[model samples]
Target: MNRFRYSSHNLYSLLSQPKSPLHPPTLPSQTLVSLDPSSIDFSNSNQFHTNSSCSSTIPSVSSTGSCPDSALASPFSIKFRSLHLYRGGYIDKGLLVNLYLVKHHCYGTSSSVNQCGFRNVGVNELRYFASHKQVRDILGMIRRKDNDLESKVRSMNVSLNLKMCSRFFEELNNQKRDALAVCDWIRYAHPSCRNDVHSMVIDNLGRLGNYDAMARVLSEFAKKKVRLVPLAFEFVSLSPLKEATVMKVVDVLKAVEEPTRGSGLCSLIKMFSAVGSFDMAELVMQLSERKATFYKIMVVEKCGKGDFEGAADLVEVMRKHGLKPEAKIYNYVLSTLCKHDKSAEAGALFEEMLASECAPDPITYEIFVCHSCKAGNFDLARKLLDRMNAQGIEPRVSMHGVILKGYFNLKRFEEAYEYVMACDRYICFPAICSTLARLYVKADNVIVAHNLLLELIDRGLRPDQSVYTNVFRRLIDTGRTALAEDLRSRLSSIGSKSTMGAG
Candidate 1:
């Protein structure tokens, strides 16, 4: 009998039953003390926008262009007036809506729409609720009843549905609107006890990478004298943190007094590394030595900022501390050096990568190949390319395009055929295909560029307008305007204008 032991109590794991359909799994139970609505305040909320006109907040002056007599009106062409304006003026579209307006005026249906039956409603109904301006207006009307315009809205009070709260989060996060800005407009303006919206606001603040903002939100959660503020501490790992601010956080964290994780301490080291504050990083590193993440980030950031000397110093520090730098770590350093036009330094780093236990990735070898060709180090580039192939890391066509150009530039016409042969499809990316097309244009081989572009499109690689423009320009310049015109039609079908300056 097979003797492998497995826990049997949780049969639901085998069934893969969903935990929650309506919401994501809960975070650590938020212990935030509820503030009275009167205590909730933001002075910035009333600051009128300087760029806005008192008369109208509609961003653009209306287009006077009318449809020609011969043209039919577009089904999708809806008027773009500033929403909820009597004529054209910015006023509070408070968050309450009359149930009657939503029931009757929304769809010309007279039926009363009361409580949303399900918290997470049907998708078809959601799509309508999301797109239809009437629901948006209703939610907008539900904001602060204190606004003079919304005084009437207070008479017919309505709280936002959970679904609508989720929608607000969606829009704000998309715009990357400041968390406090969203709070001032929605939560503070129209207070709700919904944990979902509050948690979402805090989470979004965390993601946007402001340590102070995170700390402010978490302070309301509870001052802990034992465990670390897990959520508040995440943003500290993000680089470019001011030293003065970080020190303040460090002091506050000490006061809140938690058993600190080594990883958390390491994040401070990383922030120092990002800003090239090596002394600060070293101070933290002296407290602990196994932080591989801290070392890796320092090398990449130093190289990116063109402090090759600092990056080299970090590598030496890594070795001195017995921390083994990984392959991808070396890849990042190599990419940064090559980007900054330090090919010789990049080549030197490549040698170190090879000598060390870290295997050079395809990206490392390819970058060396591209710049080596540009620098006229043809032999070195070719040797590196052969080593890259030997490693059995699949050659990207983007990388190969560099070598192909090198061959063309060297007048190695005989070798060109061998380079253009089919490569492994299992690992090929659409980016390489785009690169190949662009390379053909540079070589004045318009026919190949045109055919390859069509092939890419046929294989479900959708090029953006910029890609279309690049190829179209090349084709037009090369007197392949007929072919360019054909591609233009395809581009136009996707709503990209190909004739703006194709000449």
Candidate 2:
């Protein structure tokens, strides 16, 4: 009989289970807080319960219906039941599972070992039950009413199954036109998700001209450990997202210790050009210690926009970075100087452009000619025109119009008329007629202006209200009241007929 008892004890030892699922061994009789039922406040409860069967520490039930050891009770079954109640729409879950997992992990509970699995199961169940199109529709409506709840659900799914989240991003990347989905997936996917959704978003957003979304994606990526490529920087830099937003992204990237030496500097230059924030662009160049061809282009563009000081500063920065200013750069600076009414400086820059090995293009000659005319340097304008002709670059009708307008502005109607006739000889259609009309009106020659108007009409060029008004006022001011009235009636009839046809 003693031998039989020893054998039975050995068999029992073999069948025995481990004490807990958690590592480092869990302590016995520990109280865990329940996050279910959603409305019962347990803040005042100091009760405790035991999990081990080794001890029989029964709690006293008070007359007020409070159990002494309520805190230590195994509330897992109650919480699971509460999830069912929530699914049935009979209770508020309110992220109770998330709260439980967080609290249990914090408190070193053995039950926290299965938190990830449990959350995954909960999400799967939620997705399964909510899969019916009608149910999904309803849930979408409900979610719209409570964005916080929706965010919590998304956060739970991410924390539970990062792989699944990554797959969602992969699917989004394959979509052709659904850029919105790509953007949303990149925004909410877990950091551990394998596919780089952020990069995909950056690429597509740039293509789609969705600058706002691109900036947001850059900001999100900036928070992660992933390395940003030069193209991503370029996308963000060229986007229409504001400087403050771009700066915020830059700050986040800087914190991540991203090296900005290569194409990063080019992106910064483009970004500054887009927003007209040259100082910040220069700061980035200084920090990056790299200069690119795009830097010169950006400076020229700023000069074209009449920002001469910015263009000059950019030139200085380029030289400091050991980059020689090209012909394009000089043209931009000169154009900018002319726009700012600095004619002498502009002339000096033009001379400098010619002296340098960098040859001027047709556009450079046009800028100089126009600026000289505007500055009352008609002689200089003529000189540039002659130089352009010698270089085998024939001036277009627009160039002739510019010179005629300058002569007209200087009250040299005869010279303006001569240029108008020259424009006609060059087969410049509308410019010749428009210039003659203006010159005739200015010289109080309404008959010639009327004839030019008729020629414009014969050429299928419909003059807008400004053109008609100028002609009519000229006729009336020159004492041809009857012709002015007749022209007014004709314009009104034409406008009404066009409106009716459109309708």
Candidate 3:
């Protein structure tokens, strides 16, 4: 027996009828909640009722008297269904569609769409109702070795565009084999979009650190005479591939136009320099006109390895090349020197940077301020903040925290309290306030902490949860139940407002 009481055609046809004037349209049941109309796959109608236990018939409207209140409360159950019609039409069309997709497409229940008279419905119809999140989830299933789902999609012969493929690639989470398989699927489904897919796949593989596979794919692209873009090599510079493998990729990329080739080779120079292959870096540097860019990359790598002397040498080399070294290069070396307690060296470099007319940017000032705060030189840190203000550079809220914490660290409670009070609204970030609240509590100044929490509330800022809990607890512990209760109420209000704003 055909267990389903109604055919797909019968169900959709009956729902399309105009609602009779005597019977009003009622909201759908709670089961319709969380249903995404766009994700419903209509490819298989027989799978709709494959669950044998679901063979029971729908009850008529007269039996229930009216739509149940449970259905009325669902926010998503807005679609209306006529109660006086056949039981098949009594439920919202969206509900029926969602049930079909969940069973057949997602859960992999086996049945024949042809048997259900839905053979004419193609994957395109299913895709019309599918969301991007659903597509990503399908790709994610393929990544987790769900061969059945993969086979199902293959049978459907679905085609995705460049944007869709790029999104699906991100959801692969660096699964190299899955990326290739999905790319192959795309190539089969849409041959014209293969070139775009190639760029995405190569870039993804590079990020996955699978350059041997990337090189093979690059060679294929070369054979196809597909034009390469600079973005294709974006992540290759960070990959830890063998020198030979890197060279193999570089050789295959020779077919790329000169402009792209130059940019691509510069990325390789960064890779070589980062891996301590300076000789190879220099050799590759000779192949590109962006020698200054190559110098910057090498300087950063040298600084990362704590070779400040080598980085400075690179700066001198750039000068010799008639390329004025930027503040970025100086800041990189300056940050490293300060981190390593070579403050005197950093100060000299700062002066030299000034002499070289590399007008110190905000980062340049921040570096010195951070270093001074760390070294217990609050006076110099304050002077830097003043200089930043004089130059109209807004001091970063983080710098305020650094200076405030420096005072707290040295047990200068009076100074820390005064500093927090003196700061304007822009400087009083919630994190800084939280840090000060914590420090004050630790110093047995619960009253100040309590007051700071109130002020934060007045400024419409929610304190960190831990700080909120700590202050609220301290209030109760000090026999101030009324204040604690009031604080709890205010925090709850803030949370409610935040939730509403998000909604």
Candidate 4:
């Protein structure tokens, strides 16, 4: 008795029985606009719209519609029609046996009489194996027969057939289950598979949150000249692991030969600083041995995180690597030191950056001025500002705002006002406007504050609620409730929503 059995079921019954009474085809409610043949030029067919709304113009017959006779007229179509006919049980028994032999031999299965007969029996009865489950079982039996017959065949030709059949089952199994697994099999099984398994692995690994595994795979791929650094960076950036682990992975990738280029390293650096891993970030900088631009950014970032020692170490490393420190890096270091009350060192670094060939830009001078003012060294800050002008680097509005803020900190409103006027003449930046408004509110000059707010509005710049809210709170704190209430109402009338409770 044959181990494989096929059940008898018509193709139409197999395709359509699961659904309810089939609805008759109806014309679309939209009128079909007939194009004038003269206007329908096919020459520029490539210009057709490919968007979803236009895709329905392409016609296709329903799968349940009768197969067209015209499709079965050609030789290739006849072969396809023959397969469909075999699927529909229309072939003679002798022809069925011959076709089975041909299919088995072509696909690298055994050509023995027993195998051919088994195939014949299976093919003839395939209609009876109607359900997908039943078809799967029948294919399994065929696979077993192929595997068993492999040992009996003596020729190289038979071995080739066995290999083909094995591959066929592998493909079938892959199709039946996980696409990723199938992709992996194809990617590693044949050099000609052309599927990028690295991408598939990275995608699945990221989705699964397997960072360690992803890191390992990416490292291996990178060694093989596969560019997985971008994905690796994303994995490390989003992984819920400790910032230290993220930094470690970044360092490892950076050390890897010719790391995948573009944005990967930059994003890693940002992620490190975002998570407060300045120390580890410094290590990454040292390991990468990157250009001045990278080190300058790292130093500035470390300073922002208040890691002064880390910033200092980065400077040392820059000098050790024979890279001249730029004005931006020095400014960041100086600002950080000044904020921490290391005014002497801050001033020294500022002077050193200025003396170097990489002359201090306006931003660098601004940092020095702000630091000096913060340290109650107003004379020094004024001298630096004069020197900056002499060097032909005009102060930006931010520089004026910082000096005004410094004056306000020292209770020198007259000096702050003078700097505000100077800022207006040179560059009228939003920061300058906000600072002046804030100062006006401090001095109870509500009219000037309101005018500055209107100026900001006229310039098409939307001031954050905090800007007005801080001023209102300051006014209220100073026992100027009436003015504060009036300003609040005016702000609301202009669509500035406040988060503060009414007094």
Report, for all candidates in order, the number of backbone clashes: 11, 2, 3, 6
Tell me the tens digit of each residue's lDDT in model 4 across 353-378.
54456687887777766665655566
Which candidate leads the pack in lDDT? 3
In order, candidate lDDTs are 0.48, 0.48, 0.58, 0.49
Clashing pairs in 4: 6-125, 7-127, 7-128, 7-129, 8-128, 108-161
- Over the stretch 1-503, how does candidate 3's per-residue lDDT look in tens digits? 11113333331222233432222213223211111122222111121122222223332111213322222111112221111112222345443444334331221111332222222233322222234665766766767767565565566644455676666667664554536755666665544456566666777776676766766666666656665543465455555664555565666556455444554576567656767877677766544344667788888899999888888778877887788999888989888988987665676676667767887787888887777776677767776777777877876655676777666555555566556656644444565666667656555556677777777777677776676677788888989899889888877676544311000
User: Which residue pairs collide, candidate 3?
Assistant: 38-129, 38-130, 39-129
Q: Which 10 successive residues of model 3 have the least lDDT summed?
A: 72-81
lDDT (C-alpha) at residue 357 in model 1:
71
Instruction: Report the C-alpha lDDT of model 2 over 1-503, residue by residue, as the tens digit.
Output: 11112222221222222221212212122211111122222122222232443122222223332333432112233434323211222222333443443331121112332332233223232321112343344334333444344443444332223333334333433442334532452344333232344444454555455556655555555455444343444445545664554565445434433332233345556656667776666666555444547677577668767666666666656666677777677777866766676654555555544544557776677776676676566666666667776787766645665676665555554455445544443434454565556544544555656655555554444443344567787778878899888766655554432311000
Question: Candidate 4: where are CA atoms >4 Å away?
Answer: 1-262, 265-289, 297-310, 320-322, 422-425, 429-438, 447-503
Models sorted by TM-score, best on top: 3, 1, 4, 2
**Alpha-carbon error at 188 in model 3, in Å?**
9.1
Runs in model 3 lying further than 4 Å from the true structure: 1-263, 291-293, 322-324, 425-434, 441-445, 455-470, 473-479, 485-503
Candidate 1 vs candidate 4: the TM-score winner is 1
List the RMSD of every prediction in angstroms.
Answer: 22.1, 35.0, 23.6, 28.3
As a TM-score, model 4 comes out at 0.40
